[model samples]
Target: MKHDDYDNLNEGTRSRIRAKRRKTNLILNSLIVVVILLIGIVSFNIFFSNDEGAADQNGVVAEKDQDAASRDKKEDSKDAGKKEDSQESGKKEADESESEEEADEESAEEEELSDPIVTEGGSDANVKQTIENPEWKPVGTTQSGEHTTVFDQNAVDWQEMILAYSYATGIDKDNMTVWFNGNGGAPNTAVGTISEKGSDQTFRVWIEWVDGEGWKPVKVEELIQNDQKQS
Candidate 1:
């Protein structure tokens, strides 16, 4: 209805609208600040959690490596000990083997030097006769002025013959005279003389008899006379 009344109404409406816009802008700014703060907090938590997990994993790996190293050391020690034991065992076995070989050699030497008169076929009675009576008579004679005797056929070993002659003659084997007859007259036969009282007593004794050559005396008087001079 009038100009003055219309102007007052327009001014009041403009003031109310300006106040409402300012309040809306303040509320929107506050919400944006809250959202930014929440995002920053969440990012910090995630980063710290990842760092801690990495550190734990590194510790676990270190522990596993240490365990492996310890186990390796133990295995190495065990191998070294086993090797030492094996070497000791080998040395002991070698020593025992050497000792056994030495014993065997000694036994063989003893057998070689054993008396041949104690053979299976010969009697101990004959050996006793030669030992008790030193001047036993011979059974044969020869052309060379030598005494001879035919030892038992079964007791024909030359070593036994030497022992029997030594016992019967009472002559030391070391000091007795000996000669090897290589004429192939008889097996294990020797033509020699046993020296007594600085005189030689010749004899041709057959250890094993030959064909067409029976028991004979080579020189009975010469041998007995030498024995008497020594006595």
Candidate 2:
């Protein structure tokens, strides 16, 4: 070919080579800027791993709603401590049924003041209105042998012819201290002695007391005298 023609061809060739290189360099503009920075680092790691898995699913739904509000505040404090222990066990069984109804009304007032006097055969008891005619006083005068024991002291028990000879001889004396041997006496202690001095000499009286179930007897002071006219 001609010299100029050859030279022109060579120059063209070089230009083409340069152009190719430049094209390759922009090769995908750096592969499209590294595929757009690997798609922006995989979309910021998939949006930071979906915001840390949605904050761990909202912290497990707020720890299961604070454990269901602490198990409903411990079941409302165990049902308010079992309703205050069932209202203190129903007020301790209503104060033990009002102290057993005031101890059965004091045992029915001690069985309505006991004793009613009834000699067996269908039973009945007597005396004990606090020992019949209690309250006695005067306490003096004593001359044993020829009999002259004018003394008295009571609280409630034997007296008045030893409580009528312990109830007309059904004798069962307990806690005693009496002396009778004169001035018109009689109540069947096997014929309570004292052969006569009546119409004024008066008589019958001897008593005492200490009780809790000990010492007892009383009744006198009403024109007293006792000088044993022995019977």
Candidate 3:
């Protein structure tokens, strides 16, 4: 072949080869860029999804805690209410007990006033007559009108002497009085007697005086004081 024709053929082949290499390089660069984009998208989706799931879990836990707290508060309120009710019930019971005690005291006083067993005489009739008779003067005071007087053998019956003695000594039948008539020559001297009437015309009597809070019966052997010297 001629020299010029050969040179032209070589130049055409070099140009075609350079164009093919440029196309192959461009295709490879495009594939690498697409791979990097896909990786970035997948990473971003994974991170956001994990964050959302964590938030959901936290919200659920918080809600559960609130519910538990509310339940506990309700239970505590109920307990407080129950305690208040119990206290009220206890107060009511105490009040009732106090009222019952007062009633019992009143009843005891009434019983003491009404139940008449016996007094300083052999029978109820004798005591009643002695108290009723204005002439049945007690020994101690000149003024009559239920005043106390000593027992005088001449002034009163021997069996009903305690009635006269009680009047003279100012001793109440319900309450005991002290015996100041033990010494000689004292005025209006004689301890009182308590008596009760039994069936079949029989009678029981006790001569007693006050010592502290108790009533002590006097013995028959005890002597009667005489006020003649004082008079």
TM-score for each model:
0.39, 0.41, 0.44
Off by over 4 Å in 2: 27-31, 36-42, 45-53, 67-71, 76-80, 105-231
Every candidate's CA RMSD? 14.1, 13.6, 14.1
Name the better of 1 and 2 by TM-score.
2
Per-residue CA lDDT of model 1 for 9-119, tens digit only, reads 888888788778778878888888998999999999999999999999999999999999999999999999999999999999999999999999978765553322322
lDDT for 20 in candidate 3 is 86
TM-score ranking from best candidate downward: 3, 2, 1
Reference-based lDDT, residue 131, model 1: 14
**What ordering of candidates by lDDT runs from best to worst?**
1, 3, 2
Per-residue lDDT of 81-149 in model 2, one digit per residue for the tens?
999999999999999999999999878755553332322221112211112332222222221233222
For model 3, the superposed segments whose C-alpha errors exceed 4 Å read: 2-5, 109-231
Please list the residue runs of candidate 1 whose C-alpha ends up more than 4 Å from where it truly belongs after superposition: 1-16, 98-231
CA lDDT of every candidate: 0.50, 0.48, 0.48
Name the better of 2 and 3 by TM-score.
3
Write candidate 3's Cα lDDT for 6-73 as tens digits.
99999899888988888888898898899899999999999999999999999999999999999999
Clash count, one per candidate: 10, 6, 9
lDDT of 2 at 175: 30
